[model samples]
Target chain A: MRHVATNNRDPEPKPLSEPVFLILTSLADQPRHGYALLRDIQDISNGRVALSTGTLYGALRRLLEEDWIERFKQKDTSRDKQAYQLTSEGRRQLRLEVERMRQLARVAGARMKESEG
Target chain B: MRQTSMTILWLYPAEYREAFGPEIVDTIAQRAGEACLQGLAAYAAFAAGEFAGLLLGALREWTTKWTARDGYMSPPDFAVEAADVPDLQRRIQQLIRGMEFAIANHDFPKARLYSDRERIMRARLDRLLSAGNLYQSR
Candidate 1:
């Protein structure tokens, strides 16, 4: 195996945690409020991961701070029903993370094939 | 039980609470019956996780500020939104009540908790006031 290095000053983006990845995935389609996100994320992950209120809000705060997501109020809803949507930056990051996972899966699949052969 | 859960929300840092408090409380209240339906162990675990998550969130907020993370340079506009000032003032009043109650009961630790949240709320107000000064000068 060989490795190559480039003269980029910035580090490569890392994979997101399961909850964060799932949150972004859920929001990829449409904006959601806190409880809606909780429900959607559970559905998306086959009920394997259920985010507590504190954890979900904490991730939301970080995402807002990172400019990866944005909060907005809908006219039809009250303040407590404020919804969040993914930013362009968030979408880009989500794509990158999905690609990273895909690549890893490919490698693992190939390794399995080689062992079977 | 609902009021007690709302108080558990106070365990979070004031900044976090201010930003998402109502929604979180609403979410918990909406789901409380279901959690009860799920059985005691499940509810206990969820409560435990919520407290732990609050601690983790506070640590994260402190660390991110200490490290001066990106997108944290400018405080959010709502940080000083005029609409929030009254709410913040009301919260400060409540915190004082809490502190007084704690002290009356000789609960030093609980008093400290109220004191700490009050300090945080005041600091946020101070920052908003200072920002107002700059806005006025401009």
Candidate 2:
């Protein structure tokens, strides 16, 4: 395995990149190939975050390395048409991230209400 | 136009080029054919992003090599031996040449066959590289 050494080893999972988050979310529902993932991510983000093929693949590689996603060759598809699905660990991480954001939003909403009042 | 797309693809690592190079080029070609000038512009932007990705991929590969040590990082069980890279690279080049020749002759079926071989070779290299097999093969 290639070893990338970094000094920081935080136990907490950091917020994902836009592409990565969208990717995980897309896969949370079903496995998807490169172009499909791109389309789904754009739709999910309301067309706000369009990922180029390069960006999508780069995130896919990292996710695979982290065991957050698994790649498989679809039996019906050609060899070049690779697909990815979220692993159990990936689902847990996504849930955690969503919860964290939910809490932040809740606090922000309360603050807005107070200010308005 | 095809040549330009091919040149852009060359920015990627050899293995990466082997794996997805054709697909990316095909996408660009399709865009060029369908959208005309606008598609070419889109392809340019896409190629630029891919160029950045190539650099990023290199950085990641090198970093993995650096941080990989006993108990330092948990590398996947498979590793590519440093020695295997050259031969694999050669094979990739050969396959690519065959693909190009077949494509030039309009033998698309043969071209696809070569393309599949290239993909398989690239996956093997990725596996070896992932396993931290950094040592020379011999």
Candidate 3:
């Protein structure tokens, strides 16, 4: 898998774990609970990544712990299901990641185009 | 009103309903009830059962994750279990002890036994966590 990161003088940012990155991207639109988030990701990816229940929830746990995202609300009527929203920090991190990937793609595009010439 | 027996829960178990809130429940209830009104015998049963089955399955998955030392299971090999166990031999003994508890109550439902097994699982899980990233090691 191709990894992209910001080449800031301070330090190279770590690659977002693929599942974590994709999850964040999916959430950029609106708040999503766990299962809905899973569906959205599945739909967006066209089934390229079918997150197993374990992987989905595990990523959620880490993402919550890191303050990348947070529990937006708990469903009282529902049995123990909770919804998550991205934190401000999470949004910023996601933006940074997207930028990094864009940069990589731009460079790749130029190189590929040049090769044809 | 006719005694409408609707298996409207075409949606079934609810995924514990935590994430979805009332919306999913309403969906299930409405669907199940509608099925009853329509007199769809097999469809209602299948839908209701599925609703329960899927929700429970998801819940089971959720519980397993919370209870597990890792999100996914790897074999209880030396590398993963060894680090946390400290003395692998002794740790294995502890796991056997836990497994004994897990399998000890061979009464009825293995599903029911999970709570009991959880204790042992939790202990072993703790050891696994302390042990190190077994996958990376290999």
Global lDDT of model 3: 0.53
Task: For residues A34-88, write the lDDT of model 1, one tens digit per residue.
Answer: 8889989999888999887777887888777555777777455444367888866
Docking band of candidate 1: incorrect
Model 2: per-residue Cα lDDT over B36-114, one tens digit each: 5567776567556655654565566446546643221222211222236677777777778877887789877667656
User: How many residue pairs clash in each candidate at the backbone level?
Assistant: 0, 17, 17
lDDT of 1 by residue, B1-138 (tens): 457656766765566667777887777776666777899998787767766665676677667656752223233323433335566777778778877887789877667656655664665556555746743532
Question: What are the per-residue Cα lDDT tens digits for candidate 3 across A1-117?
Answer: 011121221256787888999899888888876667767888889879756443565567556544567554455564544467776668988888888999999999999999999
lDDT of 2 at A83: 69
Q: Tell me the tens digit of each residue's lDDT in model 2 across A1-117.
A: 011222223467788777888999999999987777877888999989877655676677667655577766545444555568886668988888899889989999999999999
> Which segments of model 3 are wrong by more than 4 Å?
A1-10, A74-81, B1-138
Q: For candidate 2, what is the interface RMSD? A: 13.7
